[model samples]
Target: MLKKQRILTASALIAVSLMFGSCKSDYEKLKASNDVAKKYREAVKYYNKKDYNKALDLFDDLTQRYRGKAEAEDLFYYYAYTNYKLKDYTSAGYHFKNFAENYPSSTRAEECRYMAAYCSYLDSPNYQLDQTNSSKAIEQLQLFINLYPKSERVADASKLIQNLRNKLEEKSYADARLYYDIGDYLSAVMAFNNSLRDYPDTKYAEEMEFMMIKAQYLYARNSLYYKQEDRYNQAISYADQFTEKYPNSKYLREAASYRKISDQGIKQAKVLVAEASVDSKVAKKLAKKDTTTGQPQSVVGKQNERSPQNQ
Candidate 1:
């Protein structure tokens, strides 16, 4: 009887061990499924909580583990969004572009396009920088417009591109104008040239042309009398360009008046330079004569150096 009792106990122990093992296997399977669900839910939860880092980490895991799963599309969008929120613009741009390219027919494609363009825009630096990123952003936004013409974001994207272009235009104009104001005519001329070349359609083109004219005029005005003829000629050429381009410009009368003054000044300056050259020669000769004599020579100093016959 004791043997039977021991056998029954052993049997009971075996059955219980098998039952526990089976339960452990089931539990592990359920835990894994729930873990994936939990992580996904937690990603959303953290995103809502503005805990972007945690959200991003979970998103990264979801994208890697469940890329072909049912929730892949949802995960992809959130991944891009999280990067955008973190201001990792380069990553955000790539992810958003990927989403848009792969899921062109998806409902989120439009958003992805917009976000991608926005990320590129965010990557753009200030106007003082090289502007390579700014140009990229403009191109992306323009492509977004072409791809999604009916999108609600179209108007805003167009306006943003215009604003960026305006910033570049303004920076160029300001740099050129600063040179003009400081009398750095050569730099001003080059800056204006670049401004026109880069943004010929800009509203500031008129002002740029006007400034070029003004800078050329000042360059002529500041030149030495004998060397001013070329500068004045260049100044008049620019003035004529401004007049032809912007006939109704507020500066037309001013430009016309400046041209007259510049022409007259060139003639007067030439005459003054010639007379001064003659006077300088005469003075040098008188100084040599004065140096040769030990006695104080007051009589020759008072006499006009020019020959009386020429006078």
Candidate 2:
């Protein structure tokens, strides 16, 4: 009885294997066939089943075959979406843009254009990395808004652009802060200024302003005595500007402290410079007197000349 049951189980397993093999062979045969409609239908079925890889393959094959035909527009649309589904954003972005450009009159043109920009947005890296994609996303999104002023997607596009801009702002702020962290005060000051200039309304404005003041003060503190007065004065000026611009800012007290320190530094530097100037002048006067008097006679020579033995 056990041997008979084992034989039955073996037969069932073989039947299942054969059925699976036949199904796989059928798909392979369909792929090799030249039946355009059948291939397109199967691609759509695969797409609906969330089999994106298989759908992508079929769409890739059918794209050129349907070119310039009525089905081409829909085919390209599916192809772009397929790439998007596969997380191939770069290719998706290109195909989406191509579809919009090729079919400007299509109702889906605006959507595709927006998707192209969104793809670029999605491709944007972290704020700590390169921001080229963020810039590109902003440009694309802005263009989309300009081209379709009445588009319902305009609001969303605008928001996306703002988000990208914020990312860029963060990158700028981080880069400037890096200079500060590394004790490059002068570079930090310049970088902070640039960040503010580029993004006047940045959320980091308050922190950046405060850091700029501190950086300038440190830069002045590290300067040579001759340059200290001017650099410290500059720091004081920056502090004053910060105070005036953000009177109620949380950094107000710290900024005021920096200003006070800078003022003290300027005064000390001026005094030292004056003392140095006086000392230099006195030294010059003594050197001149020595030069005018010629070489002095040694005391031993004078004593020897006065002694009777020398006489």
Q: Which is the leading candidate under lDDT?
A: 2
TM-score of every model?
0.65, 0.85
Task: Score each candidate by Cα lDDT.
Answer: 0.76, 0.84
- Predicted candidate 1 versus true structure: per-residue lDDT over 132-241, tens digit per residue: 78888999999999988988999999998988898788778878877766667767877998999998997888878877766665665555556666777877788788
lDDT, candidate 2, 1-311, per-residue tens:
99999999999999999999999999889889899999999999999999999999999999989999999999999999999999999999999999999999999999999999999999999999999999999999999999999999999999999898889999999999888887788888899999999999998988998888777766766556667778878878888988999999988877877777677777776776677687987445333321111122221224432211221
Write down the worst ten-residue block by lDDT for model 1: 290-299
Quality of model 1 by C-alpha lDDT: 0.76
Off by over 4 Å in 1: 1-37, 67-70, 125-130, 197-203, 221-227, 243-254, 265-311
